[model samples]
Target: MSDDELGSHYTDVPGQRVVAAALRAAYAWSVRDVHRNAAMLEIARMTGVVMEAHGPGRGPVTPLELVGVLRASLGSLLAGVRGRPAELADVVLLDHEGRLTENAYDLVCEHVVPLKDVVGSRPWLPSWTTMHSDQIRQQVFTAMIASTKQDEYVASRRFLVEHPAGDEQELVELKDRAGGVRLAKGGYRDVPEDQLYRAPNGKGWWWPCAECRWPMAVASSGKVRCRYRPHSAVFDLVPGDRPVLRRRDGARRSSPPAGRPAEGAKCVDAGVWRFVVVPGASELRIAAAAEHAGAKVLLWPFLDRFDLLVEAGDEKFSVDVKECLSLSSLIERLRRRRPSARILLPRSCEWQLETLQDALPELAVLTETKFLGQVRSAMRKAR
Candidate 1:
């Protein structure tokens, strides 16, 4: 859905009202129209912003300004949430400050993301990724942070997260990634058609998430992505080929496909495999490297609050490994829960190491290369 239309689901509830107002205010800045409504005007003033009449006026607010307004708006809204059970799924509009609160942040992660039923919902943007659900949320949050950054007048504008250079190339990379272990233990297979939801009109079927088996939407570009985004892998139909589901009689269960998911298959939640599995894989790599380097290493120390705890020579270190697509959101989350463990950004987020160090100068940040080097150095000292 377009940013301007974000608040359509908002209502008169205290928290929702602020979200609606924030969305509208963000939209107003995008369109360069002064939001004359009291709520919007109050938020703008609180954000120290004054809308000026200029151009055709459909541009995004500067990222810094957008961040400021979102912070102020959420603070005001969350104040009214005191003594109330705030469901994370209920939050629509978000900013850094709102995400810093455990309740609000958890709400965003648990429910607000992987925007429901966005399949075939809107024209695809150049920056959109169908690979992982977390990537999708990161892109959405980036767009929200860049509300005034787009030129509404431009038909084909690149978003802040747009990786135009990687578009076709990445889709090519996705070809081999379409199939995965159904629930990471039920065997590996591609998402089958019968398991997918049929479109209401029965023309075409919505794609199922590679991880969750829930229906995924298609974008204008004909790319199939999970509404939940972090599911990550993008998919495309082989064209003219349809999935065929063999029927079953009463009280009869169909035999599972060799490696594919079937309707109503028992398995773990999709999100666990998608978000945790990959990082877990990285953790193994780190653990192997640490052990190979001859240091004593522990996994899931203290019941998984941290990924790895290592004792090398006279030095000891705790590490939390993260492979988040949106460094901005990850940074915001880290600010709230200051981990005693140093953060390790895996190869996937290697590009973000320098930026993260700058953002959190007080925190120790390491890339795979640097971290492995430290492990080796510690091993040598132990020897």
Candidate 2:
């Protein structure tokens, strides 16, 4: 099959083009004075694509209309747009500030692998700007798998999950431990300015998300939260010589507030955090939960074959955690890559179990709650 045919078999070409174009336009608007001509051209191209898909009379005509439509729910934008499935209609694309919403982030990160092909190379929007997080993840994983020993790869992967953000000194130590394995240069970057909170005393600080332990985004309005909204712990910056996070919501309990000086601090690239750390957090949490329920748990067993292997009494269960914000994207991925073990939805994604089962009726799947119950029962039976 040709490249286009292969891409079409795995992805929605028109839908992905619409999403990539919308993202490029949003990034263009986010910048200051750079790539103005190229941005306009991109917006015009996006307009044409939208018109082609949704009918010239129906979709956005001007840049302002495009921005407005992007800020609305994805379902609303594609309500009558041709070729978009009904399942994705409810996914919100962008926030009021024109930033990609969490659901949109998941959609683009997982489904937009052929991004460069969909929207030909632009001088202004580099591959780094348009590429999905999973692409970077795949590159990094492939490199490690090819170069490092099995133990080395496992240790390196665990370190990334456990410490997504830390001081420069800590990162230096990580490099030293890599023992000559070529960690990708783009794996980490200085934490973005917007993710840091400026204190009243002219210093900036960052707080780790309660769940993932990565630097959270701090808005100009003093709002603090993780880029991955499912982390769900919101806070307000309490500025002082030493800044701190003050919990703003009581709906869910989270870890105690902790802050660190942002100076000389670095974090994994956004794509790495989204594709690696976010799901890794759930994998670790689920493993801990199973252990707490009196089961013996082994993480990433058999050279990273699956997420966790749990032994309760004489029963052994191998599960792969699925924690995605987009049900459609998750379903598509599972269809393409048949899993070797049963699928387990993390706490945040338990709602997807029913839909996933209905879509893949022959696939083995269960929620974290159900899995924990089974673990406890097995432990009792063994006793």
Candidate 3:
């Protein structure tokens, strides 16, 4: 399949590098301490998780059992940064503790890989960003802890998107406000430091998504492109009086124009876009409610390894706030990760209770109404 057809998973070269940087950072994190052997083993076990092969006596897979496979998979995924000792030093990844490396900031600025070269022929595995390294560590740590028992450990699991929310009114409102598609300025390849354009505010100019008005990424080809390709358009940077967006048809516009799709293109599906943002909006609401009710709440706590952690006086809860559009995908991830936190669903996805119960009967799944009630009860009891 064409790279363009595959979406950001392929065409997003900078994103891929960010993924590579994230992996390299993970490599560093795994090897950094006394826990290295355990960490590597857990990673190997997690890597070996095959959805269909999951059953009794299927795993408790050790890293040594799959080191060759894990190494091969990681090496191929990050071939671009291989053997670059100096560059690797410059690429900052999140440590196991969730702190960003001081020197790793803006690591993308130092390296660029070609768009075509980055489109590898491998099945993609979902991974958290570099910023979430600590969260990933926590997940693996939890898994490792569970594995030592020789008993099947499905860490406080839950099924999301078992069905669909009956009432999505609040979600709809939130989507209309902040969930619109956005864009940004990007480059196809690195421009000389002298030639890089700066805005009036002295910040470097980033291309904006024509439809959403969000900043797009500059790519290895030195052309500006949108990470969200459904809003992508064919364009080039015209370096005349100043750098500007020029359509393939030779039309020009002021920078960062928003609320309109690219020439001859339809705006991306609103439903598709809403799935990405509405959950976040719901999370904000949940966090606000917790705070208003006199609790200490952390959103995306510990690099967003878990969604929300709440402490109301003596009571505490770790929550994985979920709003999944696809029940299958949600189930698959839950099965693979087996998070230790309780999974909370917003009003937007209340309908999935039965299916979730059927699949993961032991999971502590709560709807928005029940969750809020629990929070209120916890706060009152604490007080």
Candidate 4:
């Protein structure tokens, strides 16, 4: 059966709504004023709904119980119900500190947050509802899509990818270069405090992720890692007058220690970095690698119709990179909009290729490693 058909069986279930409420509650709990948040109220309402449907006779489900179930496993909460895919169902949505888990971020980006066009000025949504990073990302991209011509769109997006973070002067330079592009209007902001590491000398700094070169998250415990965990460049801050990062032992990959003074640094808003810079890093890397392998690559060819058009010898490959963290969400998107080019899973997302192929057998898909190998072989054949 198709993914859409499989998803249909669970549409009647309250799993999606329950999950959304749980995530919002988690976010609310992370902030200082939990009681004042609408998410707390929403979670209480959803708790009652869940109890009525799944665990009757269990009176007064506390917020803690709801959070515990979510932290324990989504499957535990939705047991005996064929709602979410096993991959997503088994995910732990909250960490011990009540922060949204990485998978929860993926879920928010993939499904929960509707694009600006779809949201369309709904009066029912609370005015106090702060936009999630993913929601903001969707809105920014939606605006870019509506405002710019195709070539301008590609240039604007490429600018964000190449310069996710810089100082005020750099931002001014970007705007000056951008001319009338909407991205020039409001694409950046002061880096968030949570993304800065405080040193023993009391100075704060931000470190760029080795992979994406965007500011990494600095945990209170001195652990430093990229918000997008796939980057996998973890480190610990060694406090000193001039603080430095110590590459944590057992890291899957290695890179040189990196940090920058955060005093005057501004970064592309969280949404843009998450949605654009993260994937764009991979897209740029793959394009560079293919060109290195003697392939002529055109990025966002035909005025942003697709990601890359690579030509090696007489062989041509048109590719659209897929770098999402959620497999089910990716599959659903693919079902909705058929891709015009072969889907290329970047190195970080290579694990998803088999599952994607299985889900959409008719679609053309390949991994970064496989695609690069093909490019090299084609180059050799021409020689």
Model 1 poorest ten-residue lDDT run: 153-162
Q: Which is the leading candidate under TM-score?
A: 2
Better of 2 and 4 by lDDT: 2
Lowest-lDDT window of 10 residues in candidate 2?
A: 1-10
lDDT of 4 by residue, 1-383 (tens): 33234334333345554454455555555552534555566556556656654655552378768766877777777665435455666677767866666665544444443212222332323211223333444555555566547766676667778888877787678857876455645567778777887777787788888777778877767888887878776788877767788888755556545678887898876556777788889999999999999899887876566899999999999999988887876887788768999999998889998888999999999999999999999999999
Name every residue pair that clashes in candidate 2: 75-89
Of the two candidates 1 and 4, the one with more favorable TM-score, higher being better, is 4
Report the Cα lDDT for residue 101, model 4: 68
Q: What is the lDDT of residue 318 in candidate 1?
A: 88
* Best by the lDDT measure: 2
**Residue 213, candidate 4: C-alpha displacement in angstroms:** 2.2
How does candidate 1 score on lDDT?
Answer: 0.43
Write down the lDDT of every candidate, Cα atoms only: 0.43, 0.73, 0.43, 0.69
Error of 1 at 187 (Å): 17
Q: 1-383, model 3: which lDDT tens digit per residue?
A: 23233232222233344344334334434343645655454344333332112333442244443333223332332334323323243333443343333223222212322222323222122123221222222332343234333112211111011101111343234334532211111101222122234544444444445543334444334455443333446456554334566565454443433221122212211121223223555676787888888888875655446788899778888998776533543554577567778998777567777787788887888887787777788889987
Shift of residue 58 alpha carbon in model 4, Å: 6.6
